[model samples]
Target: MYYHWIDTEKPAWAVTEIRERSRRAWNSLFAEERREKAEAEEKAEQERELKEYYAEQHRFFEEMGKKNREEARRMEEQERQRKEAREAERQRKKERARQAKATEEAGDGKGKYPRWTQ
Candidate 1:
C-alpha cells in the first residue's frame, strides 16, 4: 500500500524519509530517558550503601568508646584500692613502731636489757 500525505502531494520517497526520521527521533528520546532513569537509580543505590557504611562505622566507634570508658573506670578503681592498701600498710607500720618505742621505754633506762640484768 502506498501512503500519501493528505495536505501536500509529496513524493512517496519524501514521505518515507520523513516517517523514518520521526521514528528515529522518538527512539532517541526514549533511549535518553531510559539512560537517565538508570543513572538516577544507580546514584540512589550508591547513596544508600554509603549511608549504611557510615552507620556501621558510627556503631563501631560508639562500642569502642564504651569499652574505653569501662577500662578507664576499672583502672581508676584499681588505683583507688591500691591507695587504700598502701594507707593501711603505713598505719600498721606506724602502730608497730609506736608499740616498740613504748615497750622499750617500759624496759628501764638501760634500753631493753632485761629486768634481772638491770
Candidate 2:
C-alpha cells in the first residue's frame, strides 16, 4: 500500500525502506525498555542480598558479644570464689595461732596477759 505521508505515491523500494526503518525504531525502543527493566530488577536483587548479608554479620557479632559476656561473668565468679577461699584460710590460720598461744601461755603457769597489767 502507498503511505499517506507525502503527496505522491512512494516508489515500492521507498515504501519498503520506510517500513524497515519503522520496525527497527520500534524494536530498538522496546529493547531499551527491556534492558532498563532488567537492570532495575538486578539492582533490587543486589540490594536484598546486601541487606541479608549485613543482618547475618550483625547476628554473628551479637552472638560473639554474648559469649564474651558469659565468659567474663564466669571468670568473675571464679575470682570471687578464690578470694573467699583465701579469706577463709586466713581466718583459720588466725584461729590456730590463737589456740597455740593459749596453750603455750597456760603451760608457762601464766594464764595470759594479766588484768593488772591492763
* Candidate number of the best lDDT: 1
lDDT of 1 by residue, 1-114 (tens): 998877778889999999999999999999999999999999999999999999999999999999999999999999999999999999999999888777767866664665
lDDT, candidate 2, at 114: 45
Model 1 Cα displacement at 53 (Å)? 2.0
Global lDDT of each candidate: 0.92, 0.91
The window of 10 residues in a row where model 2 has the poorest summed lDDT is 109-118
Tens-digit lDDT track of model 2 for 39-107:
999999999999999999999999999999999999999999999999999999999988877776665
lDDT at residue 56 of model 2 (Cα atoms): 100
Q: Estimate each model's TM-score.
A: 0.77, 0.79
Mark the 10 consecutive residues where model 1 has the least summed lDDT: 109-118
